[model samples]
Target: MIRSLRGRLFLGLTAIIILTGATGGLLVYRWAFREAAELQDSVLIQLASLAQNGSFSSGRPLLGVEEDTDVWLIELGATPRGPADDRQLFGLKDGLQVVMRKGQPIRLLLRTRPDGSRFAVAQPTAVRDDTAREMAFRTLLPISALIPCLMLVTAIVVAHSLRPMVRLAGNLDARRADDLTPLPQAGTPSELHPFIHSINGLLVRVGLLVDQQRRFVADAAHELRTPITALSLQAENLGSVDLPEEARGRVAALKQGMQRTKHLLEQLLALARYEAAPAERGEMPLIALDSAVKQVVADLLPQALDRGIDLGFQLVEPHMVRGEPVMLATMVRNLLDNALRLTPRAGRIDIGIYRQDEAAILQIEDTGPGIASPDLERIFEPFFRGSSPEGDGSGLGLSIVKRVVEGLAGEIALENITGSDRSGLRVTVRLPLAADRPNEVSGAA
Candidate 1:
């Protein structure tokens, strides 16, 4: 009924130890009791032999043969001498017998002398039983003491034996969601080999399934792009044809829809490609962090001008980070696009890139309505727009940005910039610096 393996093992072991100890203790006690009784009878026999040999006079009783042994020598002559109990004992043949004397049970050893006289060595039955019981209990002292020590050793051994399982659980819990590495079989108990092997096989199958899904998404997106482009071209061609005002409006809306669809397909393709890419640091090339940020901002400059939003770098420093250049560029573009779409006309967006703590840090701050607190946790989820989403965004921007950042061994954090007269979202990214970077310090521009 125990739910935990440790509890069950401990309880089972403890029960076995207790049962074994009890059984062994009972056997030893019984054997020691019998031996003590036999030995006491032999002592009485030896005392009776000594009395028959005339070693001592029998007119008086002998006492204290040894301390704590209440054996005594009684002279009962050939016939009964004193009490009726003694008379009854003298009438019996020579040897050991149990009888009542003075209304108390006694163990009497009877013997006849060559002179036609008789004497007996008698001991109280209670005293004999008490001595035997004490000796028998003494025999169990070792086993009783050994039981607890055995239980302690059992507990220690159980914990030690189950430690590997505990460590395995912790390792699995700490692993990344996408990590498909097999559990190591080394140092594990042979008994658990089959279980671990099955788990590794499951991981391999799951990884394959995930890779296949990614490829399907990428392939589907690639196949859809050509037709979507052709449709967009057809819509663009309709722009030159002379059409009524109502038809013109319809054509314009169609063109906008096509543009949105194309953007969605592109985002999907990027997401699938990034997810499918293996996260291998050695395969990634070093890229200038500032240069990438500057290029993305310049590309969006026209859109910023059209909206009168001041999109420029507040701080720039020469720093190198390890990542695929295209993926890095995609990440920057998505972040900036999201900011541009949210910020109103005349809004300001500032970008900062610098080296901090052996990492390349990129910070983007925008003068737009900050994201709601409840939406922050779910913002990075694919196709998850906030409650008050703006523009025709595909909602994959932040998701792609998150994937790229994680792929490059970096961390991204988003927070609302709070202070007096300020309400905007601030994005901070920290990526591990590439090796072989110059030691020269570069001032922020």
Candidate 2:
């Protein structure tokens, strides 16, 4: 029932080690216990033989054996000797036998001498059994100690063996949504090859599907451009003929709608094109980031003047970044377009381009009503206009800018600037700087 492979493997291996250790220990204990008992019996028989051969004086009990052994020598003449319990042992024949002494059982080895005299060497049954049990228990010490060491080794090995799978999962989790690179199979276990192959196959299919979707969107946008252009021209042609004021207003409105539709189609095509192309660092060249920003700002200056908005650079520095110039221009254009749409007439917009910590930094601050807190997080979603939407925006400006920034391996952040008397939004972008740069800081204006 264990769901984790690590848990199952560890549990099963531990159980096997414990079972094997216990079974082996039990068998060894039994064998050792029997051997010890037989050896003790043989020692008693040898002592009785030595006593009968005059190795010890008659009528004297031997005391040379270890104190804990509790062995004793008894000499019984032609009749019984000692107490009644001791006399009962003399009734037994030669060789090893069990008899009761002082109501406690004892092992006695009886032997007859050449002179027809008889003697016995005896050991207490309890003491002899305790010695055998101690020897048998000692036989299990090695296996008992080895089991824990083996269990420790097993746990370490299991974790080490599964490390690759953990790393592979982390790699997958950390990948970008559009990333469809196949998983690497090198250095992985042979048993995992089939699983890796399946994942690679899935990635290939997913990449193909994404490519098809991008192509469809791009093709559709391209197809719609012609009709939208024709409609705009037809509306424009109506302006040449004299007409009533009401008719003129309707034609103007129709022209505006056609223009908005055309803009939307163009944005869709741009987004699809950027998504379809793979962003490779080697394919990108080092571009002057500050120059790109200046060009975008210059292009929008006329629009700003028409709306009575002050648009100019606050700071400009020679910063270089790796990306296609057209893509960079597109990103800057989208950001400026969004800012221009949101800022009211007579508002001021500040732009900054500089180098910070080996990165090219682009920051734009606008004097306009800041984005609502509820919509701030989702502002970059495609076609997601916040509550109290601003002028005729397709809601795709910020989304397009975000896609372009990410495609260039840059980061973008949006936060509302707060103060007691002022409110606006600050947009900050940081892109990895190129390897070379001009050594000079342009003064802030």
Candidate 3:
């Protein structure tokens, strides 16, 4: 019923150790018991031999022997003549025998001398058996001690043997959602090779499926571009042909809708293209990041002016980073456009680009309302406008920017700017600096 492999292995090994120890201990205990009994019998024989040779008198306790064994001398005359105990002992033949002395059983050795008198060496049966059991019991102490030690060793070995599998799971959990890299098989145990191979095959299949989905979106967007453009043209033509005032207003609305549709198509194409990695990364040029950012700002500057919002760079540093110029431009433009949509008239938008650590940092701060705390976690997800969406803006801008940043091997973070005087959103991006870029900092403007 145990579900954990470690628990099951430990339990099984513990059971095996206990069973083996019990069997071995039982065998050794029986052997020790038999040997102890034989040794006691030999002691009695030696005592009888010594008693006959020595000058010991009748009913005298042996001086040189152990008292706990209750071995002593008993003199019975050549013929049985004393109490029931002595007479019974004298009735025995030579050598060791179990006999009753006064109704109590004793281990006795009877011998007859050359003078035709007899003597017996005797020990109580209970005393002899108890001494033998004590010796045999001592032999089992070591095995009893080893059982717990073996169980401890088994637990440690089970955890050690499974550490690699636990580490593999942690690595998988930490991977990015878009990452489909195959699990590595080298340096792993041979037993795990089959498992890793199966996971790698799964990753390959998932990657192919993702690629197919991206291509489908890209192709669909490409096919729809022409018709959306024609619709926009027709709407523009209608705007110019004056009609009833209500008809003019309707034409303007139709033109706006067409513009939005065109924008959505362009965003879909950008997302699909940037989401897939470039076919040849080496073909990308290492362009100046500051220069590319400035171009994007210039293109969006007129839009900011119409809204009466301030947009300009606060700091710029010369740095090179590898990426397509169009891709990078799209990334910046989408971000700025999102800010412009949410920023009220006369709001401030600041842009800064510089080198920090091993990365080129592009930070943008807007004086608009920051996103809802609940929405921050999923803000980059496609079509997820916040619960309190400020305008009729498509929610694809941040998603597109995220894809472009990932394609450039960069990280993007959005924090709610909190202060006593103001509150808004601060978006920071960190891209790996190209190897050939300059690292010197420039004075802030």
Candidate 4:
């Protein structure tokens, strides 16, 4: 029932350790029991020898043997003429014997003295068996103590062996969605090599599929741009021809529709361009982020003026980030364009560029309604305008911004700025700072 591999392996090994220990302990106990019994019998034989050689009377104190057990020294006389117990002892020959006296069992060692007098060394049978069992139990101490240490060692080895797999999973979880890099094989166990190989194969196939999709989108957008432009020109030409008021209105609408279509195609092409990483990424020089935002603002200034919307930088600081010029420019343009579309007349758009830690931060805040609560989670999806889409917005602006930011190995986050009197959306971007070269790059000022 255990779901974790670690639990299963540890338990299986633990069960085997316990089972083997039990079996070995049982065998050891039986052997020790037999050895202990034989050893006690030899003690009786040695005691009998001392009695016959030194000669002792029945009244003598025990020969330094156990005082608690029922041990006895009995003289059967030379003729076996005494009590029934003495008669039974005389009936046996020399050496050791187990016999009954007074209906109780005893271990007896009988030997003949040089003077022809015979005697027996006797101890209770139950007492000798108890001593043997206690000695046997002592033999199992080492094995009982060893089982827990083995289980501890097993747990440590299992965790250490599986650490690499845990680290690999964590690395995959933290990567960007478009990342298709192969898993590393160095330092991994040979047992896991086949699994890693399968995953790397899958990544290669996925990368190829994605590249084909991007190429298809780029080609389709290129093929459509020419016809859309011709249609726009034709509509413009028809506008100047003398026509009724109703026809003029229809012609104007036609031109507007054509313009929206043209913008969509341009946005699609830009997305395709930045969706995959460019080869020039490795050779790109450090460029000034403040200057890139400034250029995009200049290009959009005329449009802002037409709408009476105030657009300007609140703070500009020199910060260098590594990326191509067009990529940065496109990124800034789409962000500003989205802001301009949502901001009403007399509203304000603020841009800031500065350094934070090892990253360059580009932030834009606008005086427009913040995004809907339900849409924030899914706002970056392609063509996912919120519940109330406005103007000629293609909804690809944010999606393109996301792709460009990821391609540059940067992070972007959009949050709603809420206050009692005013509310807006704040877009924050953090790009890794390249080696600073402020003097090498020209300023936009």
Candidate 5:
């Protein structure tokens, strides 16, 4: 319920100080009062002893004594009171303590003279108690007064300590809704620097992704608009056709164009969906890697055979992983399709699935001209197609594979596995093993 951080900090600090001060003050007051009472009693007893030794001789108390010393004299006017009571001597002192009444504490020295006379010197207990109380109050007053000052200083320190958070909040508040600029701060404490740097890095990534989305939408609209308009124009032209052979040929060409346009549109939609989905969905089901790989290989075998390319599976295990089956299938299908599309006639393509420690490994190797090392990294980027003799491609296959791999918390690597007899490319996909599986047969089982 204590929302204001500074307020809470000040209160906590003040509470600690007050408790410590009260405890120390209580201890000092008790010790000082006890010592002062002892000093008073010792003075009273010593004075009484000296008086009894004839130190106070005549009618007066003492020689050269200050006028402040009040010594009471009591002569035995009539000694017929009773048997000498020792208790009476105990209370009687060398000095008068007239102000200290019955039941009131007093410090007094009492002496019984040789002639059955008594003399006493006394001071009230109130004197020592009052002095002790006054000293304690004096010490406590300044500390109590300084509490407010201490609170102010504490508040300032807390504010300075939290200045970075305040600045970050202010920056966020001032930013535009669409602004994804990195937060700017300098001289921030080291403890908070990592948080600030993380935020800045996130902003940079989100900003680039937003920029990419904007460009993708614009380009998609532009790309689809032409084909859509062409289809509409062809539909319109069809109604006005008159000749036989010539008109039929025109119709066929227009139909082909429409099909191409439709295919392009579908690919664009798929790419958009791949990009727009949440980076991580709630949870994925466990899918068998062998089954997924074999399905993909089977679906692409016809295409591979059409080009005289050999395609087969080399699975070491039916590795199971947590993944969206459709997405996993898409990734495998794209990798195989990419290989089959580029591999020359009589080339060999190998697909394998197995568990490797805590990961599921899917490796695809194709006997195609290996990607030049410089272009390997760029091949997975959207709309990137390397120098392959095969004609135009939509360039989204490897990109889709990369996106799906990342979405499933997996990794893929491409390397040249070319040999003396064949030049080829190798792709390795590694997905994190399911949490329920203890030891994967691949390694460290």
Candidate 6:
């Protein structure tokens, strides 16, 4: 499991302070101990020198002599023979531990006279004990008191450094689900800005998808309810039909309306699926524009012939685009289907492919009751109905066309081809040119 950033930072900062304090403490201790030993050695050497050179006030032998008080000096022969003599000589030194029967640890200073006789002066360990203790206490005691203060300061610094992250976390925790706005992190560290920016991007995308879903659901319900209610009414009417030609015609019209409603619902479902995907639309068939258009026209030609409309193509060039063949075909079929259904008998409809400015353009123009200027853009929205001669459409057709064009990174635009009365609807589609195709005609015999 991942630990929080604040906790990790605090731990790391505290550890650094601890290491620094430990290193400083070790150095201080070493310096204090070495200085103590040096001071003791200097003081003892000086006292020993004074003892060797100076004489007593009485001018007699101060060393190896007894005194009225315990404060007296002692001088011992380097090679003493008897225990009694050594015990008597040991009493001369004041407050010194001297074992005359063995070697003693004392700082000795030697003085030489003109007669070449040597006198030795010694200060025993007790002479400098109190001074050494005082020096050690003075040097090391303050450092011992500083450790706690250092720890407190380290903790404070760590807390201060992590306060921003704490606030950021709290801000995030208190947010509502509908909050798509960015987190209010004005003073955030540079190290975390990329993460913040990435999250904001995610929020934007998710918000868009959520809005789209809401619209889809609302529109689907509104469109589906009308047909379902009509069907229910039709079923009621079925029980009361004492059939004449007029009654049968009403039933036939009702059945056709039901079929149209079902078709519209299916189309809406497809549009929803296409919009809900989070990733790129997957690969589709490599279809030639001419062939795909020709096929759709072939399928719908019978209806056109029945309406006495002349549906023809202008293949200025053969161009191919990458798309889901089914979706692309649907898009073309819907556009042409709307045109054929709306155009009056003897109306001429043109399907043409041409290139302009390095893009493949498919133009579908029909001399039918063209869309009004205001309704051109609105017609592409789902379930929209235009005041025209054609039967009411599922309204998903144009929307499906738009979705397919966007999925393939293409564009669509409509213009009124009529001279003055807004009588012809012209739709132009532009697709990107293929980049990795061989320079030869494809699917050519």
Among these predictions, the greatest TM-score belongs to 4
Q: What is the C-alpha lDDT of each candidate?
A: 0.87, 0.86, 0.86, 0.87, 0.69, 0.66
Total clashes, candidate 4? 0
Per residue, candidate 6 scores C-alpha lDDT tens digits across 24-121 of 76677667766765665554344445555445322133444333211222344443334673445433443323333235444433433344333344
How do these models rank on lDDT, best leading?
A: 1, 4, 3, 2, 5, 6
Residue-pair clash count for candidate 3: 0
Q: Which has the better TM-score: candidate 1, or candidate 5?
A: 1
Task: Report the CA-based lDDT of candidate 1 relative to the real structure.
Answer: 0.87
User: Which scores better on lDDT, 1 or 3?
Assistant: 1
- lDDT by residue for model 5 over 293-400, one digit each (tens)? 777777777888888998997666866777667677777877887788778889899877777788888888988887888888799877778755353356877887
Q: At residue 236, what lDDT does model 4 achieve?
A: 92
Global lDDT for candidate 6? Answer: 0.66
**lDDT tens per residue, model 3, 87-152:** 867777898888877777888888898888999888888888899899989999999999999999
Residue 6 CA error for candidate 3 (Å)?
A: 3.2
- What 10-residue stretch in candidate 6 is worst by lDDT? 65-74
Model 3, residue 128: C-alpha shift (Å): 4.7
Query: Candidate 2, clashing residue pairs?
Result: none
Clashing pairs in 4: none
Cand. 1 TM to true fold = 0.78
Question: How many angstroms is residue 250 displaced in model 5 relative to the true structure, after the best TM-score fit?
Answer: 9.3
